[model samples]
Target: MRGIRNMVLEILETAFIQRALVTGIAVAVICSAVGFFLVLRRHSLFGDALSHMAFGGIAVGLFTNIYPLWTAIVVSVLAALGMTKLRQSTKVPPDATVAVLLSSGLALGIVLVSISGGFSVDLFSFLFGSILLVSPDEVYIIIGLSAGIMAILLLLYRKFMYIAFDEEQAKVSGLQVSKLNYLFIVLASITVIASIRLVGILLISSLIVIPNITAMLFGKGFRKTAIISGAIAVSSVIAGILISYAANIATGGTIVLVLVMIFLAALVAKKAERTKRLAGIKAEA
Candidate 1:
C-alpha cells in the first residue's frame, strides 16, 4: 500500500504526467460527447474516416515542414465539410462516400510518407500517440479546442439531437438538416484532430466509439448515456496513462485496451441482467 501510494504521488509530481492527465481528460470528454451523437446517427465510422483524413493532413504538414497539428485540423475540417457536401448533393450512399474519403486520405498519407523517405519519429508519435511527451503548448491547444467544441455542442444540442434521431423529420420541420450536418461533421473532424495526440490516428476512433457503446448497453437516456460515456473515457485514460507509466508499455494502446475491457465487462453485466430477468419471468410463468 505504501509503495502504491508513493508511485501515485510520484506520478502526480511529474510535470509531463500532469500535462498528459489534463490533455487526456480533455480529449476523453470531447470524444465522448461527440461520439454519443455519432453513435446515435449511426455515423460511428465517421470518426474513423476523419482520423484517416487527419492522417493525410499530418503527412502534408510534415511534408511541407509546417506544424502538423494546424495542417491536420485544416485538412480534416475541409475533408469533413467536403464529404458532407458530397453526401448532401449526390445520391451516393453515405458509407460509400466515407469509404472513398477514407481510402483516399490513407493513400495520400502513405504516398506522402513514402515520398518523404520514411516515417520520421515525429510522424510516428502522431500515428501511435505520445501523450506523455505532450508539451505545455499542446496541452493549451487541446484544452482550448475541447472547450470550443463543447460550447458548440451545448448551443446546438437540441438541433443535433433532432437530426440524429430523424434527419428527414428535422428537414420537414423547417430545420436546415444539411447545414447542421455540415456543422456537426466539422465538429467531429476537429474532435479527431484534438484526439490524435492522446490516442493517435490509428486508435482514435476506438476512444471515440467504445465508451459510448459500453454506456449504451445500460439502455439509458441520451444525457445519462453521454455522461456515463464521458466518465468511462476519462477513467480509462487516467488508468491507462498510469499503468503504461508503471509497466513501460505504449500509452495509446494501453488506453484502448482499458476501454475494451470496460466495454466487455459492461456487455457481460448486461447479458447477465437479461438472463436473470428471463429466469424470473419463467419462474412467474
Candidate 2:
C-alpha cells in the first residue's frame, strides 16, 4: 500500500500527467452533462457523427497548415448545423441524415489523408488519443469551452429537460424547440471537439455515452443521474490515466475499457437487486 501510494505520488508529479488529469476532468464534466440529455433524447449517436465530422475538419486543417483544433470546431459546428437544417428542411429521416454525414465525413477524411500521401503521427494521436501530448494552452482552451457549455446547459436546464422528454410537447408549449435543438447540437459538436484530445475521435462517444447509461440503471431522476454520471466519468478518467501510466497502455482505450467495466458492474448490481426483490416476494407468497 505504501509502495502504491509512493508510485501514485510520483506519477502525479509529472508535468504531462498533471495536464492530462486536468484536461480529462474537464472533458468528463462536459461530456456527462451533454451526454445525459443526448441519451434522454435518444441522440446518443449524434456524438459519434460529430466526431467523424471533426475528423474531416482536422484533415482540412492539416492540409491547409492551420491549427486543427480551430478547423475542427468550425467544421464540426457547420456540419452539425447542416445536419439539423437538412433534417428539418428535407424528408430525410434523422438517422438517415446522420448515416449520410457520418459516411461522407469519414470518407472525406480518409481521402484527404490519402491525397496528403500518408497519415502522420500527429493524426494518429488525434485518432487514438494521446493525452500526454496535450499542451498547457490546449488545456486552457478545453477548460474554457467546457465551462461555457456547462453555463449554457445550466441556464437552459429545464427547457432541455422538457424537450428531451417530449419535443412535440415542448414545441406545442411555445418552447422554440428547433432553436434549442440547434443550440444543443452546436454545443455537442463543440464538446466533441474539446474531448477529441483526451479520448480521440474513435473513442470519444464512449466517454459521452457509457457513463450516462450506467447512471440510468440506478433509476434516479435527471439531476441525480447527471451527477452520478459526472462522478463516474471523472472517476473513470482519473483511474484510466493513472492505470495507463502505470501499465504503459494506450490511455484513451484504457479509459473506455474502465468505463465499460463500470457499466457492466452496474448492470450486474441492478440485476442482483431485482433478483433479490423477486425472491423475497416469492418467499412471502
Candidate 3:
C-alpha cells in the first residue's frame, strides 16, 4: 500500500502522467456516454467491428508513409457508412454485416502488415495501444472529438433515447430513426478512431461497453444511466492509469482490467443490496 501510494505521488509529480490521466478520463467519459445506448441496442459487436477496422486504416497509413490516424478515421467512418447503407438496402442482419466488415478489415490489415516487411510495432499499437506516447497534438484531437461527441449526444438526446427504449414507437413517431441511426454510427466511428489512440483498437470496445454495463446495475433512469456510466468509465480510466504507472503495464489493458473489476464490484454490490431489501421486506411482513 505504501509503495502504491508512493508511486501514485510520483506519477502525479510528472507531466506525462498528468496528461495521460486527463486524456484517459476524457476518452472514458466519451465512450461511456455513447455506450449506454450501445449496450441496450446490442451494438457492442458492431462497435468491436469498427475498432478492428480502424486497425486496417492504421496499417494502410503506416505502409504508405502517411499519418496513420487519417486513414484510421476515414476507413472507420466509411465502413460505418457502408454498414448503415447495407442495413437499409438488405434484409441481412446488422451482426452479419459487422462480421463481414470485421473479417475483411482484419484480413486486410494482416496482409498489409506482412507485405510491409515488418509492422509488428504498429500492429501491437493498434491491438494493445500505446497511450504513453500520446502527444500534444493527439491530445487536442481527442479533446475536439470529445466535444463533437458530446454536442451530438446532447443535441439528439431525445431521439437517441427514443430509439434506445422503443425503436418501433420511435419509428412510428416519425423520429427519422434511420437517419438518427446513421448519425449515431458516425459519432461512434469518430469516437472509436479517437479513443484508439488511448485505448487501442483491440480493447477499445471494452472501454466503451463496460462502464455502461456497470451503470445498468444501479442506474434507475436513462439520464441516470448515462451519468452513472460516465462516472464509472472515468473512475476506471483513472484507476487504470494509476495501476499502469505502478505496474509498468500497458495503459489500455490496465484500464480495461480495472473496468472489469469495477463491473464485477458493482454487480456484487447491487445484488447484495437487493438481497438485503428482500430480507427486510420478509422481516416486516
Candidate 4:
C-alpha cells in the first residue's frame, strides 16, 4: 500500500501524468453526459458509427500531414451533420444510416492510408487511445470542449428530456425538435473527436455505452442519471489510468476494461437487490 502511494505520488509529480489525468476526466465527463441522453434516445449505435468515421479523418491527417485531431474533429462533425441531413432525405432508420457511414468510412480510411504508403503506428494511438500522448495543447482542447458541451447540455436539458421521452409531443408542443436533434448529433461528434485523443476510435464506445447503460440500470431522474453517468465515466478514467500506470499497459484498453468491470459489478448488485426485493414480497405475503 505504501509503495503504491509512493508511485502514485511520483506520477502526480510528473507533468505528463497530470495532463493525462485532466484529459481523461474531462473527456469522460463530457462524453458520458451526452451519452446518457443518447442512450435514452436509443442513438447509441450512432455514436459508434461516428467514432468509426473519425478513422477516416485520421487517414486524411496522415495523408496531408495535418494535425490528426483537427482532421478528425472537422470530418466527424461533418459526418454528424450529414447524418442529420440524410435523415431528412429518406425513410431510412438512423441505424441504417449509421451503418452505411461506418462501413464506407472505414473502407475509405483504409484505402486512404494504403494509398499514402500506410500511416505509422501512431494511428493506433487514435484507435485505442493514448492518454500519455496528450500534450498540453491537447489538454487545453479537451477543457474547452468539455466546458462548451456542458454548457449546451445544461441549457437544453429539459428540452432534450422531453424529446427523449416523447419526440412527437415535443414537436407538437413547438419545441425545435429538428434543431435539437441536430445539436445532439453535433455534440456527440464533438465528444467522440475529443475522446479519440485519449481513448481511441475502437474503445471509445465504452465511454458512451458503459456509463449510460449502468446509469439506466441504476439511476433515477433524467438529470440525475446524466450526472451519475458522468461520475461513473470519470471514475473509470481515473481507475484505468492508475491501473495502466501500475501494469504498464495501454491506457485505453485498461480504461475500457475498468468500465467493463464496473458494469459487471453493477450487474451483480442489481441481481442481489432484485432477489432481496422478491424475498421481502414473499415475507409480506
Candidate 5:
C-alpha cells in the first residue's frame, strides 16, 4: 500500500504521467461510448479491422514523411466508410469484407515497413502503444477528438440507439439508417485511431468492447449499460496506467489485462446472483 501510494505520488509529480492519464481516460471514455453501440450492433470486429488498417496508414505516413497520426485518421476513416458502402452495396458478407480489409491493411503495412527500411522504435510504439511518450500536442489532439466524438454521439444518441437495437425497424421507422451507419463507422474509426496512442492498434478493440460486455452483465438497459461501461473503461485505464507505472509493465497490455480481470470478476458476480435468485425461487415454491 505504501509503495503504491509512493508510486501514485511520483506519477502525480511527472508531466508524462499526467499526460498519459488524461489521454488514456479520454480515449477510454470515447471508445466506451462508441463501443457500447458497436457491441450491441455486433460490429465488434470493426475496431480490430480499423486498427490494423491504421497500421498501414501509419506506415504510409512515415514513408512519405507526413504526420503519421493524422494520416492514420484519414486512412482509417476512408476505409471505414468504404467498408460501410461495400456492406450496403455488395453481396459479400460483412465478416468476409472485414477479413479482407484486415489482411490487406496488414499486408500493406508490412510492405510499407519494408519500403521505409524496416520498423523503428517509434513505429513499434505506435503498434503497441506508448502513452508515456505522448507529446503535449498529441494530448491536445486526443482530447479534442474525444470531445467532438462525444458531442456528436450525444446529439445523435436516440437515432444511434434505435439503429443499434434494430436496423430494419429503424429503417422502417423513417430513421436514415444508412446515413447513421456511415456516421457510426466514422465515429468508431476516429475513436479507434484516437486510442492508438494509449492502447495501441492491437488492443484498442478490447478497450472498446470489454467494458461494455462487463457492464451488460448487470446493467438492465442501454443507458445504464453505457454509463456503467464508460465508468468501467475509464477506471480500467486509470488503474492500468498507475499499475503499469509501479510494475514496470507495458501500459497498453496492462490496461487490457486489467479490463479482462474486471470482466472475469463481473462474470463471477453475475453467476452468483443468478444462483442466488434461482435458489430463492425454489425456496419460495
Candidate 6:
C-alpha cells in the first residue's frame, strides 16, 4: 500500500500524467453516458465500426500532412451519418451495414498506410494509444466536447429516453426520431474520435461498452444505469492508469481489463441477488 501510494504520488508530479488523467476521465464520462443509449438501441457495434472509420480518417490526414484528429472527426461523423442513411433507405440490416463499413474502413486504412509508405510511430499511437503522449491542447478539446455532449444529453433526456425505448412509438408521437437518430450517430462518432487518443482505435469501443454492461447487471433503470456506468468508467480509468504506470503496462489495455473485471463482479453480484430473492420467495410460500 505504501509503495503504491508513493508510486502514485511520484507519477502525479508529472505533467504528462496529469494531462492523461484528465483526458481519460473526460473520455470515460462521455463514452459511458452515450453508451447507455447505444447499448439500449442495440447499436453497440456502431461504435466499433466508427472507430475503424477513424483509423481510415487518420491515415488520410497523415497522407495529406494534416492534423489527424480533426480529419478523423470529419470522416467519422460523415461515415456515421452515411451509415444511418443507408440503414434507413436500403433493405440491408443495420448490423450488415456496420459489418460492411467496418471491413471497408480497415481496408481503406491499410491501403492508405501503404500509400503513405507504411506505418510510422504516429500511426502506431492511434492503433494502440499513448496516454502519456496526450498534449494539453487535446485535453482541452476533450473536456470541451464532453461538456457539450453532457449538456445536450441533459436537454434532450426525455426525448432520447423515448426514442431509445421505442423509436416507432416516438415517431408516431411526433418526436423527430430520424433527426434524433442522426444526432446520436454524430455524438457517437465524436465520442469515438475523442477516445482514440487515450484508448486507441481497437479498444475505444470497450470504453464505450464495458462499463454500461457492468451497470446493467444490477437491473437498474436507464438513468441509474448511466449514472452508475459513468462512475464505474471514471474509477476504472483512474485505477487502470495508476496500476499501469506502476506496473509498466499499456494504459488502454489495463483500463479495458479493469472494466472487464468489474463486469464479472457485477455478474456475480446479480446472480447472488437473484438466488437470494428466489430463496426468500420459497420461504414465504
lDDT by residue (1-285, candidate 2, tens digit) is 999999999999999999999999999999999999999988889899999999999999998899998999999999899999999999998889999778878998999999998899889999999987899999899999999999999999999999999988999999999999999999999999999988999999999999999999999987899999999999999999999999999999999999999999999999999999999999999
lDDT of 3 by residue, 138-164 (tens): 888888889989998999988898898
Candidate 6: global Cα-lDDT? 0.91
> Candidate 3, overall lDDT?
0.86
Go through the candidates in order and give the C-alpha RMSD of each one to the true structure.
0.8, 0.7, 1.8, 1.2, 1.2, 1.3
For model 4, how does the per-residue alpha-carbon lDDT over 1-285 read when each residue is reduced to its tens digit?
A: 999889889988888888999988999998898887888888888778888889998899888889887888888888888888898678988788889888867987999988988767888778888889788888888999989998999898889989998999999999999999888888988899999877899987778889989877785876677778888999999988988987899899888888888889989999999999999999999
lDDT of 6 by residue, 210-249 (tens): 9998998888887788899999999999998888888899
Better of 3 and 4 by lDDT: 4
Each prediction's Cα lDDT score? Answer: 0.94, 0.94, 0.86, 0.87, 0.92, 0.91
Clashing residue pairs in candidate 2 are none
In candidate 4, stretches whose alpha carbon ends up further than 4 angstroms from where it belongs are: none
Worst lDDT 10-window in candidate 1: 176-185
TM accuracy, model 1: 0.98
Question: TM-scores of all models?
Answer: 0.98, 0.99, 0.94, 0.96, 0.97, 0.96
Estimate the lDDT of model 2.
Answer: 0.94
Backbone clash numbers for all candidates listed: 0, 0, 0, 3, 0, 0
**Of 1 and 3, which scores higher on lDDT?**
1
Distance from true position, residue 69, model 5, in Å?
0.6
What is the Cα-based lDDT of residue 4 in candidate 5? 72
lDDT of 1 by residue, 28-97 (tens): 9999999999999898899999999999999999999999989998998998889888988899998998
Question: What shift in Å separates residue 256 of candidate 4 from its native position after superposition?
Answer: 0.8
As a whole number from 0 to 100, the lDDT of residue 217 in candidate 5 is 93
